[model samples]
Target: MAGVIQEFKEFAVKGNVVDMAIGIIIGASFTTIVKSLVDDIFMPIVGLLTGGVDFTDFFITLKGAGEYPTLAAARAAGAVTINLGLFINACIAFLIVAWIMFMVVKAMNRLQRKAEAGTADVPPPRQEVLLEEIRDALVRNSTRP
Candidate 1:
């Protein structure tokens, strides 16, 4: 039990694990912001451009025999609906997240490349230089048949 507890502590406190947990928390918050952007901002503009057509009202009623003004109404009426608008909203949010993540990875990769390139000017160890000289001397002596 003590060994298990110690192992758990080590695993939980690892930099990678801690970073992942922080990423997950931030991702959850970002999702909320994205949802609001899609639902409150983008959807409203889209609706206006399409002549006041509320996309959230776009649904297929599979087991109800009436029209619904909104998703809440459909649910309150106990209607079985496949909400296409919600799916569209989710798709938009996913695209936003994916694009942002791609940009972040691109920037990180560029920085990494620059850092690697900067190290190219560094000199090798003296031990390696001496070893190479010895090898060259041996090769020169052997070749003098």
Candidate 2:
């Protein structure tokens, strides 16, 4: 029991675990933003361009009869519906999130490469430089007539 508690403590305090927690929280918030962008902004524009047909209302009635104007009305009428428009909206949101994550990872990789390149440009230690100079002098003297 003591060993399990200690192990749990170690895992909880790890940087990776903390980072993952933060990522999950931020990802939840980003999901809301993406949903709003797709539903409220993008979909409206798309609907306008497509002749003002609200994608949210695009559904196929399976069980209930009679024509309904909107999804809410169909649901209120106890109709069985396949909400393909919601699926389309979800797909758009997923693509947006994917593109954003790709951009973020690309930026981080670029920054990491720059940091590595900067480290590689640092000069050698002064002791190594002096030893190289001494070695060159010795070689010059040995090769002299």
Candidate 3:
């Protein structure tokens, strides 16, 4: 039990574990923002461009005799409906999130490459240069003697 507890403590304190937890929390928050952007902002513009066809109200009745105009009405009438509009909204949100993540990863990769390039161009420290010269001198003297 003590070993298990110690392992758990170690795992909990790890930077990777903490970073993952923070990423998950931020991802969830980002999902909400994306969902809102898709449903509230983009969908409205799409509806306007497509002659006021609201996607949220679009659905097909799977198991019902009465014809319902909207998804909400179909649900209210206890009719089974395939809400394609909601699915479309979800897809749009997913795409937006995916694109943003892709851009972020691309930027990070670019920065990482720049940092690596910069490090490669840096000269060795003066102390290291002097140490190498001393070592070479010692080697030459030892070889002579």
Best by lDDT: 2
Better of 1 and 3 by TM-score: 3
Summarize candidate 3's per-residue lDDT along 1-145 as a digit string, tens digits.
9999999999999999999999999999999899889989999999999999999998999998789988888998899988999999989988999999999999999999999999999999999999999999999999994
Q: How much lDDT does candidate 3 score?
A: 0.94
Residue pairs clashing, model 3? none
Lowest summed lDDT across 10 adjacent residues in model 3 is found at 64-73
**What digit string (tens of lDDT, one per residue) describes model 1 on residues 7-65?**
99999999999899999999999899989998999999999999998888888888886
Q: Record all residue pairs in model 1 with backbone atoms less than 3 Å apart, i.e. clashing.
A: none
**How do all the candidates rank in terms of TM-score, highest first?**
3, 2, 1
Candidate 3, position 25, lDDT: 100
Q: What residue runs in model 1 are displaced by over 4 Å at the alpha carbon?
A: 124-145
Would you estimate the TM-scores of all the predictions? 0.80, 0.82, 0.87
Say which prediction, candidate 1 or candidate 2, comes out ahead on lDDT.
Answer: 2
Candidate 2 on 4-93: residue-level lDDT in tens?
999999999999999999999999999999999999999999999999988999999998989889999999999999999999999999
Q: What TM-score should be assigned to candidate 1?
A: 0.80
Better of 1 and 3 by lDDT: 3
Error of 2 at 121 (Å): 2.3
